[model samples]
Target chain A: MKGADRSKLAARLAHDVGKYVARAARNMPPRGATPAMVAMLATDLYSLAGGRRASAVLAELAGPFGEGDERLATARSLLEEADRLEDRLRAAEPAAVERGRAIALEVQSLVLDFARMVASR
Target chain B: MRRLLVIEDGSEYSDFARLYLADEFEVTTARSASEALRMLAAESADAFLFDLRFDRAEPGTLVGDVDATARRLFGGDRGRALRYLQDQQGALILAELRSAGHAQPAVFVHDFPERRLANLRQLYGSVAAVASFDARAIGALLSR
Candidate 1:
């Protein structure tokens, strides 16, 4: 894709990811989310990690913008962590939900950072 | 550049403004109503930008009395009242700003329903809103 198109897509992804992270944070943790709630969050995180959309787009953009981009690298690693969190959630681990929430917050910050990078470009 | 004051519970809106609106606006940010008021008292701004949902804001920093709202609207359910306050904190902050005699135009990046949007305009003069973080659209609203 062209640079302009890539930037647009990055912005859109950042917006979507930020919104998802906020919603997931609200539904998790000290609010006393149920096991089913954690499962649902895990399912969505699975999609965000390697499913057809977000990961593919991130990989494509990484080719052009990822070089020497610490934020992009961090975002990629965090997504990998998200994937692991999903697995732990599937196993119904005790601390997995809280861990997922922490990952979601990190993802939210990185999404904003990604948007900032795209806007600067 | 016009000075734009952004108020939100988190840094997203302010970060966007700095990254995308920097050429058109000199951005200032506040994380709560009291902070915004203090900033306004120190300097003037050409416009204001608000984030509608403040789910991450500290409870004490949030506007509106949770107890009062619970009694009046939520059958004394403080949890529900607290959620309502977080959901509507942006508007509450704007109300405080208005009461403080700041009449600058205020903009929000939210797609409020028609009636709700109308109500906001009715309550707060010089209010504007767009549905998303399109920089050009936001700049236009702020410039207006």
Candidate 2:
């Protein structure tokens, strides 16, 4: 059985979302989105801002986590980090967008390793 | 023989898992993600065991990246980052498997004692079972 979890899609960006806080965190005047929610939007941005090759990770790296109340703060912070990470990908001149995907993949592998630790438990 | 693949990094709990599960399943345990991927490629294990932490850093990557991303998100609703990481792992594993050409393989998450299996079932349709990392939980998943 190799289907993706419909309940918990990897968000193509972040993945360590806790259900508790997402449910608990609420907003009166909700911002754009939470850190968890905007992870997907970030994916869209990563794709559109950089284009197909740059945002190739549109499929696997959508991010996750955070709450409704924390959407703006979360989105802003992640967007900042994404920019820095993109800089790393674009190191040594203007790099291809897939460079970010490569970076995301490598990082995701580590995440997978850590996940193995928990599943074993 | 029932086939099961356990991907672990030599945790004490993994040993308990083998002790408890070896009798019931033709258990094949791999200590690394690569090893597990190989076994999965060659075998149709009924279940998969995934852990969200590792000691050895992966080639061409740093632990800080995943850690930083995890901390920023995965707080779930309660701000418990680690638990959030593990839960997200459940989703990622299945996604990778699908990309790799596997059908809907039943997944068992044994890390959360307080976290009910139903919660995962509600969130992730493919989750077969979730328990406090006990043999009984594994058994229940396999039963489905």
Candidate 3:
């Protein structure tokens, strides 16, 4: 696409930061949050990669959520896995960052895949 | 007291559930699946109430958005991706549960989407009894 189109997509994704993060303990539920929140989180990561195409950004998640599947349960499992692991770490309990980060990575991948799916769809 | 485990994702519905079921069962609440599993791993609970909507713009939506975007990208044939999304969520839930080693657990839920209970049942190798805890009255009856 054109440079402006690419820039707009980034802005569209990056536009909402606060609502995206939702300041909730991984142990806390995200019922009050929306799909937009997750979308923004995905964008934040994409921005770090710098000038990546939307499809390129979603490389990690293309297999699962990237196809517009949103597999809520799978996503939930991934999200929960991350949250639980982190909660243990932050609370000074026996935390496994690797395990949690693995889950987070899955989520990040899924989110990127999702963004690509959205753009492609 | 019959024990109840609430696995929610930090949403209004989770509290809604706790409020209704707390009267009858010894309710232990976990906003995320991981927290719920933590409780489960640590102790024994009679039943579980899991909220499938874990995070906002959850994986499910990502799938849908991708499908939509792909349709735009390819200019048609979006159904395949949508189908994949529907099946994958159930697969993940089952994987998570089995990986967590939850036993023949009865589940109470509202939005499981993609009709995963069937797969969940098959994975459990037997039918897991499921109930709707969406209404206070129904929850009251089920908790009994």
| Candidate whose lDDT is highest | 1
lDDT of 1 by residue, A1-121 (tens): 6777676566555644644443444334544666655655564466543343334445565556545667667767776776666667677676777776666666667766676667567
Q: Write the per-residue lDDT of candidate 2 for residues A1-121, one digit (tens) a residue.
A: 1223322333222223221111111110133333332332234334332343223332233333223323323334443455566544334222323333334333333333333343344
Question: Per-residue alpha-carbon lDDT of model 2 for B52-140, expressed as tens digits?
Answer: 43323232222123555555764433234443444344344544565566553455443343355566556545566442334565566
Give residue B33's lDDT in candidate 3 (0 to 100). 44
Q: Provide per-model DockQ scores.
A: 0.04, 0.02, 0.02
Residues B34-114 of candidate 1: C-alpha lDDT, one tens digit per residue: 999999999989999998878778889999999999999999999989988988999999999999999898998765556
DockQ (model 2, Cα): 0.02
lDDT string for model 3 (A42-115, tens) is 33222323433223333332333334455433545565454444445343332343343244444434433433
Q: What DockQ results for candidate 3?
A: 0.02
Worst 10 residues of 3 chain A by lDDT: A15-24
Q: How many Å off is the CA of A68 in candidate 3? A: 26
The TM-score values for the models, in the order shown, are 0.58, 0.38, 0.36
Candidate 2 regions exceeding 4 Å error are: A1-121, B31-33, B55-91, B104-124
> Each candidate's lDDT (Cα)?
0.73, 0.41, 0.42
| Number of the predicted model whose TM-score against the real structure is largest | 1
- Show model 3 residue runs off by greater than 4 Å: A1-121, B57-94, B111-116, B125-133, B136-144
What is every candidate's alpha-carbon RMSD to the true fold?
A: 16.0, 19.1, 15.7
Best-to-worst order by TM-score is: 1, 2, 3
**In model 1 chain A, which range of ten residues has the least summed lDDT?**
A48-57
Between candidates 1 and 2, the one scoring higher on DockQ is: 1
